[model samples]
Target: MKTIKILLPIFIYILLVDLSYAQSKQNKKQSLIKPVVEPPIEVERTTPNNPDQYQLRLIMENDAFGGFSDRYYTNGSRLEFHMSAGESNPTRKVFSYWNDLFITPNEKTRYLQGFAVGQEFYTPTNIKKADVSYGDRPYSSRGYFTNSLTTFTEDTSITTELELGMIGPSVGGKSAQINFHNFIGSPTPQGWDTQIPDSYSVALKTDIRKFYHRFFGTQYNVNLGNIQTDVSFGLIFRFGNVDKTPGPGSSALQPGSPILHEDGKGYWYFYVNPGGTLQAYNATIQGQMGSDKAYKSQNRSSAFSNWDSFLNNPTPDVGEKELQYRMLSEDNGKNTLQRYILFNEFLVNGTTNPYNIGLNYLIFNNIFNGAEEIERTTRLFLLSNLSAQWDQIPTNARALAIYSIFRPEGGKLPPIVRYYSYEVLSQFILDPKQRETLLQLLREEAEYRDNKTYIADLKRAVGFIRAGFVSVSNAGFLFGLHYNYQTIDFQAAKGLPQQHQWVGFQLGKVF
Candidate 1:
């Protein structure tokens, strides 16, 4: 009985072991033969037929659009073509690669490309003045070409742009303004002669936005380049109905297709983009890149008693060179040109060369300043004669400074005061008879006196833009108006307007 029991237990144990091993082998074989699967992943593919169309947009902006205004922000016009790269297009891959390199995107985002050619021109409040209005932005203009890419998804979008252009007389700002002004019988600008100098310009720009409910959103934009650089962040408010997200079709993007949510249905809305721009550089307001200027003019013989006198001087009427001799009253001291190069250097993070203007100054003593106006003029005459034989004349700081600001003509110092400053004049100046002759000349000049004197220092400029702008859109047409209570742009004197009003119009149609 014991043996039977032991054999039965061993047989049962063997059978059990065999069965377990066979089951393990079967499971292993099955695992080897079958492929392991990951959780089913959702693949995203672009919707078909979304490309649909291309468009051309004409954007126009001007101070005139605001009416009764023909000054600052004078005119801007651009023609741009925009087209979406359909999912299957070759351009789509190009855009995708470009986007991958610069901006963010997802598989669901749509892409578009834009190309444009444009011009922008600005002037001081007094465009009629044929000189740099010392306190206002000098005449400035730019002509440029731009290439941009945009990636959008539903209510969010990002855009990156590259602009290549030039700023200067070559931009045709003066001619364009003149033609437009003539057509409208408006005051024509005559001071483009001192416009921003010719310089190559390049800039990169990016815009990021998020909109909700199709009525409001926020925008952040940044521009960096030789032409314009700024960071702008603001809120956008819409007061009408459009069945689509305001961003993708927003004209603010590259010339966009009309926000046609439903075919044949017109969409109209008025939007306000209340924003603040932390402006850093503007080539138009400040001088252009590179040298502040190639050459500068100095007071010649300084014979003229007044600007009119300089104009009437028998000096050869050379073109701009002669004109520069009397242009921007940058000659605040009325004797030497004071450069804003240092101030500009601090303002612009660009390369620039300061002018090497050798000092040809007439220094005088402070005592000459305490004296009455009559004595001041007489003593200056004395010093000029004394220095007639020397390379430079030394006078006290106060006397020379006092004499510098007052126009020679305002004191009736007469052009003769300088003309007689030849070496021969020194020999006779000390003689009693010669002194009386000079005194008599001064006395006669007193008859031609006026009240005006030194011009105020040129206003230091900073880049800034703070304003409220309104935009209206209807059936692909856009119009904008800006009422800005300005910042100090460039003022050399007091009393220039501190506020400006202008208009903007952007109209586009798919061609």
Candidate 2:
């Protein structure tokens, strides 16, 4: 158990030095002068009132760890704690003169302190839709608490954080997502009672890195408020056993981190962290930024059309850079979320002094911009109900290309995406009663053929892999078992053949 809590105090100080050397050899019986033994003197807890040391981490994210079906950017979790970056910054009591004008403490900075609490939830893509699926990616959730401070030097590092949160449905996201899917029996999302309500959230994040060696570097991140605002830049490649430079190895396990041993000696490594971002706002995909209450007690007016249900009750904060290209479509990457994130780690560790243990293998690939904002509210609910009759709207694309030969391209099916793409709505809706009233509103609109998924090659997506196998103990615990995969962000005209796998797991500890 954490190596007997760090070797039970050096095994009770070597049994009190062997009972004071058998009472001084029976009172110096023939004093054969010989006595020399000294060990057990360690120090380097530079302030933070000599924290002595501490660590704890617990993180989780899911798509069921890539089992192949759940919903968009599903579950997420967090629990973190740390100590001893020591040089100063034990919560900088009253920002000691404005945090020393940005941490200048010498002896190669390291100032650390972090505290966290988390929760994130989102679903759609059939969490057994009970209401409002209109264009998927609705039911939201968020719950947070954070406070951080870090200052690394020996390259460069500067972390900063401050957050307190709430997003909707009191962040329960439907009873922690249906009591964890009835304890893993799956199926029970019922749309968090049409989520994304509550309010009061705050944010402020910052990350900066500089490095030039220990495997190259460069990074910059920013987050503002109202739940999310953005800016980013990235790169930070590390080869195996890296980090003698860089900073924060307190086993934060990014692409697998596990370093820190002042005698308990133990090591191992491998990491790759690529990144990207430009999102401007994302209160769970464009809701609740100014005046939000996601429709107060839920009434997305059943995706609209009871002769115009309250003029489209609660639904009109579109995104993806405000899309408007109507009549049949394309984004090649859908909603252009398009951020590139990848992580590959490999660890193998074991220590004793300050306790540490390990085992790792994580390969995470993330391609976003697909299901965010469900293709901009399915083209603003089809340009607000076919714009008062075809000023140029007849988009049934030949019965969705003859209902795409009975669906099944859940991935890899973009040869100009056809299945008889109905020759441009039969050569311009050749009036047969306006092409059968836009082909019966494109077979009951079904979120416009699930946002008429498209990806005419632009270097692929609909993919969001998440490989796994993690285990680290004592020295900042963490457990994992991923295997996520994604491709079909949306597309269900009643042919749910899976395209969002899951099988994720993670448990952590240290302290």
Candidate 3:
């Protein structure tokens, strides 16, 4: 009885252990059969296609002058002004403002509102009477009476430009833009004369935006109008963080240095523009003044006097005559000899980031004349530009070449006149150490070219570098010098001192 009892307890214990083992196997099998529940699938968010934003821009410029005048009188000195002519050297001020507003209420649509205004005026200053003459006539005479010929001449002018437009929905990843802008108002001419007629102008432009894949390129724009007709292509590159805004305009990355952004991240782009235009101009008024026989005869003597003296003279017959002569000559008896001009340009912009390069070639033919003459008068232009940002060496360089042939069927001079020009430039940004090295290189080059004809009739080379610090933004400024040279070979004078040379500094923006 005792043995049986012990054997029964042992059998029960074995059965319990077997039961526990079976349950553990069942749980493991169930775990293997169960399905996985992964976290929700992730999706990327994209920027909406709506346009709404505001933009403002301002530009300021100043220039200094020092050169010998063709008339033998000193070019004189004056306070620096923007780019007005008569305000030369005299202190001049200019203000320009541009504002843009964008509104978008739906996807793939946008509207633009823009306004621009500019004002420029010269402070009154003393003036002096100067002599001026015209043509080869030496009969005209005039004089200015004043205290040291110093009189205050003040001129102020303003201009306003406005635009309103809409952009259509993007197609095939490309957008279309159509806009109308009105250019109205009177602005002073470049010189001190400050004389320009008020005029109204309207322009229409159409282009495909972001035509190529993001990296490959942008669009080509076509413009048509009385002022100009041309086509241009742009190369685009971007950098920095992008904003998730409606429309491309507002989404432009903010301006900054050492930009940061990832692939698919919104960024800013810089585009280089290469374009050409066929332009026409009819200075009927000036041409008439140049060819008017009566006006020329009346002002014959005054035409030889200094420009200032002749301008102040009460009986300015020469002025009337010159105006009439120009008018008649331009009319060419048929009432007009339609004048035409052609221009080509290569533009480099790093405003966005990762500078770009572009090149353009243009031809302007005087089609107003017969085909044979047109072939002879054709003008050609070639322009190229480069922009790049490397470690401490950010640089922009440009080259231009222009060739023109002027032919007068009935003039006493040669049947054809040829004019040619070539220019090269480089603008650089350097750290302090790099700047010193660059300056030294420049000095060495200048010394090598000194007293040598680097260019035709070019005798000397001069350069200036300016550095300054401002308190507001603590902005540091560094600007290099302007260099220019000109050489002319006059064919009419033959052996009579027909060669002229001009070399000087132009103080202003580098690009």
lDDT of each: 0.48, 0.44, 0.21
Model 1: what TM-score?
Answer: 0.55
For all predicted structures, in order, the TM-scores are 0.55, 0.29, 0.23
Mind giving the per-residue lDDT tens digits that candidate 1 earns over 293-314? 5222222112112322333334
lDDT tens digits by residue: candidate 3, 275-301: 222223211111111222212222222
Please write out the lDDT profile of model 2 over residues 1-511, one tens digit for every residue.
1222333354345435434553564356435535554432324443432334556656666766445457766776666565554223335343233434544667545555566666777676655433333344566777766666655555666666677677776656677677778799775565465555677789877666666786677766667889777765656565544344443322111212212222232223444444555656767655675552333211122111121222222334332212221101221222222211110111012211110110000000001112112223543554344333333323443233222322221122222222123223223323455445444443454334333221111111233333444434335444545554454433332233435555545554445
The clash numbers for all candidates, in the given order, read 9, 21, 47
Which pairs of residues have clashing backbones in candidate 1? 135-490, 135-491, 135-492, 136-490, 363-395, 364-395, 364-396, 365-395, 365-396
Ranked by TM-score, the better of candidates 2 and 3 is: 2
Q: What is the C-alpha RMSD of each candidate to the true structure, in Å?
A: 24.4, 23.5, 34.3
lDDT winner between 1 and 3, please give it: 1
